[model samples]
Target: MGMSVGPSGGGGGRRRGGSRAPMAEINVTPFVDVMLVLLIIFMVTAPLLVAGVPIDLPDSRANALEQEKEPVQISLDAEGQAFIDDAQVSMDDLPAQLEALRKQRGEDNGDAPQVMLRADRSLDYGKVMLVMGELNRAGLNRVSLVTTGSSDRP
Candidate 1:
């Protein structure tokens, strides 16, 4: 003889023949993998970031002078190729180049082009110093070094 059982006290109803319910928890591995992939993509693309050219300038403790206008960026790569505001400027043409650069900034009140020197630390200080001297000779007395502001520094 077949015996009939009793009803279970569990909250939900029991299905005689049906598919089981799926788990509530979400699969996180795919999300994590996607996140990691995104991180890697960003890392790979980070170096491709266009900057105002790279220059390894020396560290200085003195506060930089305030500029009323944006200063021209001069970069000195390790090879000693000098760049004035991203333009390849020869040392001999520095003064004349700066004159034009100053005019480009508008309102040429005979004001010197504010120069910001960015030289590689490995570069010969002679080149950077020579640029400074030439800028001075070109009548650009205002020069500054671009650095991470202490406030913005990590």
Candidate 2:
């Protein structure tokens, strides 16, 4: 029988540095694929990550204002159900809940706590104003209405 020689010119023998050169080239296709998948997942989930209750916010041409501190989030759904942050509370208890929250944040004696109110687009104007009145009577004077940016410019 005759022996065959490999590319290294060895007679069925292993090369000094081994068969493969430790794979000098890196496979970037998988890396790129994983990165693209992660990007798509983030894009799909980023909108759902917003805190507080979900509601159809009305479009507004008014410019958004910046705040110095984290404001209290109050939401009113289409059914007029009130929520302080994510916890549901009746309209009657809204003031007390806000007071408890203010006391916990050490804002009872300090600067007033800012309030961000999100009301559904389908909610009645009078209902929204009623909640605003409640907030005012609770000593939370600084309030900002949260609305989506309108595509049309005034």
Candidate 3:
């Protein structure tokens, strides 16, 4: 005599007629986890990437200027010492160095390159002005004074 088994009575839950198909849907859980980890790493490192010579910038309420290209950075410390990018430069050599930089930027024909001046808050206004004068004499007229935002004030 032949006997029939019910649906739940089972041959290890296998169907009698057909085999199961492979899963076709993608598993996004691992991809999302990796992406989140990469995002966290970037968030932690982004600020450190904006490295430059440290200087306490003066506070200002002036609106920030729009920039099209990377500007030449000039920094003056509280001791009135000057720096072009990160290298120390003497006041005597500043103008000549700036002129060389201008020429390198191909500003000789037209459209002068911008110079961003960052001066310590403790520096004298005259010292900053002198640097600005040197920059102007070098024909780098497109100058922007870098200052910290005044949002921290009450």
Q: Please give the CA lDDT of all the candidate structures.
A: 0.72, 0.86, 0.86
Worst 10 residues of 1 by lDDT: 2-11
Task: Report the lDDT tens digits of candidate 1 across residue range 1-154.
Answer: 5544535444355654444776799999999999999999999999887556776555555676767777778788888887876678777777788666656763547666677877787888788788888777666777876654344333
For model 1, what is the C-alpha lDDT against the true structure? 0.72
Model 2 over residues 1-154: C-alpha lDDT tens digits? 7656877665857776676646688889999999999999999999989976879998898888987878889999999999998999998888798778766764646766889999999999999999998888777788899999864855
lDDT for 144 in candidate 1 is 74
Estimate, for each residue in 23-76, the C-alpha lDDT of model 3 and write its tens digit. 799999999999999999999999987636778887887878888788888999
Quote the lDDT for 43 in model 1: 98
- What count of clashes does model 2 give? 0
TM-score, every prediction? 0.55, 0.71, 0.76
Candidate 2, superposed: residue stretches over 4 Å from native: 1-26, 106-109, 151-154
| TM-score of candidate 3 against the unseen true structure | 0.76
Work out how many backbone clashes candidate 1 has.
1
Estimate candidate 3's alpha-carbon lDDT, on a 0 to 1 scale.
Answer: 0.86
- Each model's total of backbone clashes: 1, 0, 0
Maximum-TM-score candidate:
3
Predictions ranked by TM-score, top down?
Answer: 3, 2, 1
Q: What lDDT score goes with residue 38 in model 2?
A: 100
